[model samples]
Target chain A: QQQVKQSPQSLIVQKGGIPIINCAYENTAFDYFPWYQQFPGKGPALLIAIRPDVSEKKEGRFTISFNKSAKQFSLHIMDSQPGDSATYFCAARRYRDDKIIFGKGTRLHILP
Target chain B: DAGITQSPRYKITETGRQVTLMCHQTWSHSYMFWYRQDLGHGLRLIYYSAAADITDKGEVPDGYVVSRSKTENFPLTLESATRSQTSVYFCASSGYFGDKDRWYGYTFGSGTRLTVV
Candidate 1:
C-alpha cells in the first residue's frame, strides 16, 4: 500500500505560470512533510519543507499549502521557468522516526 | 567532498552475477538509506541503517543486501542480479541541526544507474 498518494503523474505549464502538485497521506503520525526536485543524471535534492503547525509556508518562488485536517498538502511554483522543469516528490516522516515515506512522483515540464 | 557519494555512476551486469554498489558520506550522519528509483514507481526504500552495524529492510529487499560496518560507508550488494532489479540506486544520509528545535534533512548521492540483463 502507498502511504502517500500524489496526483497528476505529469504536469505541463507555460513559462511564468504557476504549477501546483498535490499529495495526500494516510498516516496522521507523520509530522514532517518535504518536497524534493530531481533533474536528469542527478539525484533528488531537497526543495522545500513544511510542518503541520502552519497552514502555509513559502520560500522564494515555492510555496507549500498544508491542510492538516484533510491530510493533504500541495506544492506551488510561482513564475515557473524552464529550469524548474524536473521530477518532484512529496514525502512524509513520522515524529522521531528515521524512515521517510515518499510518494510516487510528479514530472513537471515548463514550456518557454 | 562533504556530501554523500555513490560509486560506478553506471553499471551493466548479466543475470545471476553478483554486484556491489558502494556509498560513502562525509557528514557522519547517524542515519543512512538506500533507495531505488524507477519510472511510475518513484523512489522506493530498499534498506536503511540508523548507525554502524545496525541495518533494517525497507519496502523492497527481496534480492538486495546492505551493510554499514562504519559510519561513513554503507554498501549494498546483490547476491544474484536479476533483470527486474535494473533501476537507478541512490544513497542518502540524514542529519539534524539547531539547538532549540532540531531540523532534519537528507543529502542524496549522485546515484548509480544499474542495468541487469
Candidate 2:
C-alpha cells in the first residue's frame, strides 16, 4: 500500500510567486516529515523537515506546514526563483525506524 | 571527502549478466540503504543494513542481492540483469535514530544510472 500520497505530479509558477506541494500519509506512527529537492542528474537533497509536534517549519524561502489531525503536510516556496525549479519529494519516518517512505514526487518549474 | 559516494555513475549491461553497484561512506554511519528511482514510482528501497554483517530487504528485492561486509561498504548486486532492472540507483547513509540531533536526514550519494539491454 502507498503509505504516502502526493498531488500535482508537476507544477509551474512565475518567479517571485509562491508554489505549494501537498502530501498526505496514512500512518500516525510517523513522527518525522522531510522535503527533498532534486536537480536533474543529481540526487535528492534534504531541503527542510518538520516534526509532528509542530505545525510549521521554515528555512530561508522554504516552509513546511503540517496538520497532524489531517495527516497532511505541505511545502511552500516563498518568492521562488528559476533556480528553485526541480523535482521535490516528501518523506515520512517513524522515530526509531531505519526506513523512510517517500512520495512519488512533484516536478516544479519556476518561470523566469 | 566526508560523504557517501557511489561508483560508476553510469553503466550498461547485457540482459542476464551480473552487475553490481558499489556504495561507500566516510562518516561510518551505522545505517546504509539502497533505493531505486523510477519515473512514476518515486524512490523505493531495495535493501538496507543497520551495521556490518546485517542486511534486510526492502519493498523490492527480487533478483537482487546486497552485502555489507564492513561499516563503510554496502554493495548491491543484480544476479541476472533484466530490462526491468534499468533505473537510477541511490545509496544513502544516516546516523542511528538515537542521534536525532545529528540526523538532519539521510545524506545521499549522487546516483548511479543503470541500463539493461
* Residue pairs clashing, model 2: none
DockQ of 2: 0.84
Q: After superposition, how far is residue A67 of candidate 2 from its true place, in Å?
A: 0.3
Q: Write the per-residue lDDT of candidate 1 for residues B1-117, one digit (tens) a residue.
A: 588989989999999999999999998898999999999999999999999999999999999999999999999999999999999999999888843147557789999999999
The CA lDDT at A104 in model 2 is 98
lDDT of 2 by residue, B21-114 (tens): 9999998898899999999999999999989999999999999999998999999999999999999999999784565754778889999999
- iRMSD for each candidate structure, in the order shown: 0.7, 0.8
Worst 10 residues of 1 chain B by lDDT: B97-106
> Per-prediction TM-score of chain B?
0.96, 0.95
Q: Each model's TM-score? A: 0.98, 0.97
Compute DockQ for each candidate against the true complex: 0.87, 0.84
Position A78, candidate 1: lDDT = 97
